[model samples]
Target chain A: MSKRVALEASHACCEAVRMADTDVVAAYPITPQTHVPERLAEMVADGELDAEYIPVESEHSAMSACCGASAVGARAFTTTAGVGLELMHEVVYIASSMRYPIVMVICNRALSAPLSVWCDHSDVMSVRDTGWIQVFCQNNQEAFDMTLWAFRVGEDPKVLFPVMVHFDGFTLSHVTEAMFLPEQEEVDRFLPKKRQYQFALDPDKPMTHGAFGPPDMYTESKISQEVAFRKSKELIIQGWKEFGKIFGRYYYPVEPYRAEGAKTMLLMMGSLNETAKLVVDRKREKGESVGLINLRLWRPFPFEELRQAVKDAETIVVFDRCISFGGPGGPVFSEVRSALYGMERMPKVVGFVGGLGGRDVPIKDIEYAFDRGREVAEKGSEEIFETVGVRGKVEGIREPKGVYLPAK
Target chain B: MATKARKTKAAVKKLRTASEVTWRDMEVGGILTDAGSAALRRTGDWRSERPILDKEKCNKCGLCWLYCPDAAVDACEDGYYEVNLYSCKGCGICAEICPKEAITMIEEEEE
Candidate 1:
């Protein structure tokens, strides 16, 4: 039987890791993400969980340690935040290429220039091409559910890729919310006690992992990994179906809310989707044809499901928490546009950058997004994306003409 | 080292070389299931200069075998250390380390 309890999102993630019966945990302390490993350490010390808790000096070492643990066929897990994720950026690629089924929960935070410890998608966006299977969480329940699901999905023999579970830093990580906690027996049944690793380091049967690939073999090796990664999407969907069958909580790659016959839709990811859903509800009450699309899966980008969800809508307002610098709006916005580029009857996709670095996104801001999105669809705008709720005039800060020479 | 060499020989017989395999045939994660598969690569073709051993001047001290980075120097049954040209990259470390000056590197002419 599953029991309901209030838990911080970080602690909820740790509880799922415990239930997964992870063999090893190697993590460094970082804000918002610190509570996860801290709680796991306490669980280890109290003999509640039998796992090796490695208190690594830095995020680099933490990920490296996980690679080593996972190489030896151990069920390894880790957690990190903004800067920590950046520090371990290179190793993140190695984990996936080597096909280690290590699970990590990223307490998503803003990248630093002004050094703010807040919630945003900047950290996750940077590692978008790192080859790890990534999923975003909208609330505490999803955080717990996805962390557990990550292990089962990643460790499957058919899909031995690393997984990253992302949840907003202070907004979701620090907030307490009620969630269903399943018994260990049910979890054990879902994820078997014996892990079947196709390749592992063993003295009895010697095998080489991460071997030097010569120029002749490098391209073929990369192509094989690419094909395998793309094929893992089928297994990901199947894993979710099985989890839903047992747990009674179904999850989809792109989940929709009140999207039936809607002409306008708001597409978003992470914890902000919860707030956006409420805004959608209020809009619907006022006889507005508004709907919400929550992007749960980030990688293996769910291009098909996204297209299907917005087929009926006339315009999609994509709210991105991070900017793509000078590029065409945010990363999500660019990909969404690219996906809908050649479609026969595509909807007008408007990009908006907001809620950056822990900035509170009030109801008025989301309402403004809908109004502005429809306006842009009707009368096209010159700007690539509009900033939501930003103070001061952005038009005044123009580049000084002839001061900086143009490249030849 | 001897057991690993034997295992490599056995694995080489059963497995196809990496170049002969396509992306569909490659193992998951590109992990080489057989240990010491590097021996099957035959890197000797990379050699611009080949090491020549003088059997008359050789002391059979085995220093050439000990210093060969690629483990290309093979100790024969008669106790003479000979360079196995198939695996030698011709770095000439064996010639440089030979205490008796029994080895010399000669530039190979294109066939």
Candidate 2:
């Protein structure tokens, strides 16, 4: 039996992790994520979840420890944000390359500047190429479900890669919502005990691991990893299908809202999906043909799904939480445009950078993206692919100077 | 058993003993170049900068030289990885991937 409560989303996520029964939890506490490891620690102390909780000093150590634990065949969980993730950047590659199913929940927050702790996608974006499968959640309920589902997804032998469940810090992390918390038995029955360590260091097996592959074999090694990752997309679809069977909640890489008849759509990731949905509904009431498309999965990016979602639509307004300075376009927008480059009727994608410091991007502003999408359809083309919001004209279109981390 | 494993390690470390293995000496007998690369930049150097180990860390791992597609790195001793620099174009991938982080890339500082 489960109970529904107006609980904090972070707590709900931690509860799902506890219910999923991860074998190992290693993390260094940071804002928004503090509630997660803190809750797990309490559960561990109370014997609610039988797991080894390693209190590491830094996110790098935290990931390294998780790698060691996961490598040895333990289901590992960790959480961090912003610079913590930046520090763990290299190990993140190691975790994925080694094919250790280390599940991580990131409270999506801004990378420090003017030292902002607010919600943004910058932290997750900075580690985008770290080779982990990334997922974004809209609200508390989805956050809970995805956190639990991440373990099943990552630990799938076919998709042995780390999964990061990202929710907007302060926005969804601090916000209280009535979430349906499931029974431990239900979660256990739904998600199996991580099968025999998919890749194990067994004396009997005596296979070499972490050994340098000769150039003759290096390309093969990389091709194998790439091939394995490409193949995992089907595993993701099957996993989602099974999760829906058990949890009664469905998920998609790109989820469409009121896109049935809408000619233009406002697309975003993370918590802004809800805001965009509300704005889209309001516009639709007045007979405006606007819709919202939420990009749930990033890595093994649902390119085909995204193309299918906006193929018929005349325009797509992409809200990129993090900006790729001096690039052709925003990272999300660039990818969306590239994905549809082969489409018969490709939606014109316009990029927007808003709610940067975790500041609230009002529903009205989402409406603005739709408004710009309409304008672009009528205009020749959007000269600046980036949508400049009500705040200020996009300034200093150059790299923000900072000290380089000496470590590679 | 431990001693046997140690001896096996010693035997594997034999490839790095050569003082120098130069590009001129390389036969290029075996490596099949990709047809695409061959068509695009037929004369292009695909080799990256790899460490030509001076027998210091040659534990006879055979990983470096065995793994060197262009025969850039070789093994001299048991469990050691060495680089043959004549063909190495300074890719630094060996440095990044070394399990022991034994390989280091010292960029030639410009004056």
> Can you list each candidate's DockQ?
0.67, 0.04
Give Cα distance to truth, residue B86, candidate 2, Å: 19
- Candidate 1 clash pair list: none
Q: Per-residue lDDT tens digits of candidate 2, residues A105-219?
A: 8988788767877777788778877778888899999889988888888888768888888988888888899988887777887789664553465555444345433444455
Across A76-126, the per-residue lDDT of candidate 1 in tens digits comes to 999999999999998999999999989999999999989978988999999
Q: Top TM-score: which candidate number?
A: 1
Off by over 4 Å in 1: A396-408, B1-17, B44-48, B54-59, B77-81, B100-102, B106-111
**Model 1 agreement with the true structure over B26-61: per-residue lDDT tens digits:** 787878898876776655766899989999999888
Interface RMSD of each: 1.3, 13.6
Superposition-based RMSD of candidate 1 using all C-alpha atoms, in angstroms: 3.2
